[model samples]
Target: MLILTHTLHLNRPSGKVPIEIRLYQPLPTGASWICNFEIDWPEVRLARHGVGEDALQALVIALQVIGAQIYTSPYHEDGSLRAYDREDGYGFPVPSNLRDLLIGVDKMSF
Candidate 1:
């Protein structure tokens, strides 16, 4: 099992909110990599899972959900939720800075 830990900083209006993350990858031969992710915040304790060959992919998926929660949390500065228009006609709110942590790791192919 591959265990990874990270602390994410979300630049909120109030201040920089720190979130703790723990990711586990159990890569068994002949099977896809399954990742278990956990997030910790002052008022939120969340867990999620994803299956993918690359850890970054799983992290990305998990972050999407976590980001949504943070964006909509009462602690968020914007009283109203923010939305974005996509070319596919789907809309999504601005993601949290947790997603930004993957930028450097995303470029390298494992």
Candidate 2:
């Protein structure tokens, strides 16, 4: 069982929104593990972040990591979800066009 926890600070005009999570449910692939995810922590932030955009992308990228996928679990002890090979995620954020020059540049072509 591999659990991934993410923390973000949402600044809202009404008040400061705090403590959001991205939960990944682990799955078995062949003999190793894989993951799919759903959100379980805060409902309010979902209103602002809008599901299926930022949330799922973050979880997927985090798991298909280059060197490591094993991390600490953040779910409550009684959390009843289990991981599987396929991921059923909800609510992700649409991305902005702003590019980070430090990443994803094709150096050989340049």
Candidate 3:
């Protein structure tokens, strides 16, 4: 099942590109909760997996991994154009954004 889906608008010289991220739950036969994720780029689609104890944990790991990929990518540099996370209503500040998303989780019993 698809757990989460978000679109990020990345700035390009020619125009803005829409990058979609989709996260899915682990398969029944999997040993652990494998968070499968896909990044739909303009020209290509990338897939990867993250292992966690639960669905929420898996999702967090997947997002952090993808965020690092974006931070080091050539698409982001010192430019007027910036990438925006439409769902979160914020720019690509990487770990900060990820941290903000997990604000309340830190205090949770889990």
User: Which candidate leads in lDDT?
Assistant: 3
Which tens-of-lDDT digit does each residue in 17-93 have in candidate 3? 78787878765336557678887866789899766777666666776666655555455333322334332232222
Q: Considering every candidate listed, which one attains the maximal TM-score?
A: 3
The candidates, ranked best first by TM-score, are: 3, 1, 2
Model 2: runs farther than 4 Å from truth?
Answer: 29-33, 39-60, 63-110
Q: Per-residue CA lDDT of candidate 2, range 4-104, in tens? A: 55543333456434444444554444544444533333453221111223444444544333111111122212222223214311122212221111111
Give the candidates in order of lDDT, highest first.
3, 1, 2
After superposition on all CA atoms, how large is the RMSD of candidate 3?
6.1
| Every candidate's CA RMSD | 9.7, 15.2, 6.1
TM-score of each: 0.42, 0.30, 0.62
Q: What lDDT would candidate 1 get against the real structure?
A: 0.50
**Clashes by residue pair, model 3:** none
Q: What is the number of residue pairs that collide in model 3?
A: 0
Decoy 2 TM-score against native: 0.30
Residue by residue across 1-110, what tens digits does model 1's lDDT show?
Answer: 44766665554568666767676764433555556777776676887776666656655655455555545565444332222122110122224453332222231311
Model 2, position 96, has a per-residue lDDT of: 24
Cα misplacement distance, residue 88 of candidate 2 (Å): 30
